[model samples]
Target: MSRIEKFCAAFPDGDAERIEEMLHGYLWDSISVRDTAVRKNMKEKFYHGMVLGLLQSRSDWLVRSNAETGEGYSDILVYMPDKTGIVIELKYADDGNLQ
Candidate 1:
């Protein structure tokens, strides 16, 4: 089974709360270290690297960054055979208006 499949088997309903909790627990120190190093200039690449690092153990999933799609490029793409894929678009909050 794929990593996502195992996750779904455990959570069954895409549990955002549990996922967030797990990520926060795993990434808190890494993010803090990155924050201390970069201070005010934290970029999307940092977060992307952290995510990639965290998910590196999921060998069944194909993870890519800055992949070109048809019309544009995707920041991150997580693919699993015969299952749902994940596309992430990374954006810096200070660069554009999110409202």
Candidate 2:
């Protein structure tokens, strides 16, 4: 089986919460060297694109970037194979303020 097939087989329900947990853990462990801050020059769009690619690669799911919603535009929208959708909003904080 392929990587996507394996992931789908492992998570048949396309559990957004579980995927979120894993993704969060991945970002937490993969990055962050100074308490809660990351290296300089890495902006919001960079992380946003990275996450978009990661999600697509991991699950091969249909993901839309900067999707329009009733309220406003969202940073990311993911369509799961189980006929569910996940919306994500992204934010950025420069070196000056992240509070």
Candidate 3:
């Protein structure tokens, strides 16, 4: 079975804590801080690609990057088959130019 199918099956009642833990673990285990800074100037696109690659592994989830909303673009958008969608925003923590 696909990863998404297995995930849904494992959490038949949609356990939010388990799902969050799984995602957190995946981010910690699969992505490396060193691997994220391969170039001199890392842009949001780079981070987006990293996250997109991870989400794409789930055969049942549809992932979109920089999707336009009514106000602005969302950094990452995840659509589940039978549940609410997920919207993710990426920002530089040290950047002081946020509005």
Each candidate: RMSD to true structure?
4.8, 6.1, 5.6
- Position 51, candidate 1: lDDT: 61
TM-score of 1: 0.62
* Candidate 3 TM-score, true structure as reference: 0.54
- Each candidate structure's count of clashing pairs: 0, 0, 0
| C-alpha RMSD (angstroms) for model 2 | 6.1
- 2 versus 3: better TM-score goes to: 3
Candidate 2, residue 98: the lDDT equals 46
Instruction: Assess the local accuracy of residue 66 in candidate 1 as a C-alpha lDDT between 0 and 100.
Output: 81
What clash pairs does model 2 have? none
CA shift of 56, model 2, Å:
1.4
- Local accuracy of candidate 3 as per-residue lDDT tens digits, 20-58: 566556667676776657553465566568657766776
lDDT of each: 0.62, 0.66, 0.65
User: Which pairs, if any, clash in model 3?
Assistant: none
TM-score winner between 1 and 3, please give it.
1
For candidate 2, write residues 5-96 as lDDT tens digits: 44333444657566556656666766665434545545677678866776677445788899889978999998877787777776665654
* Clash pairs for candidate 1: none
Backbone steric clashes in candidate 3, count: 0
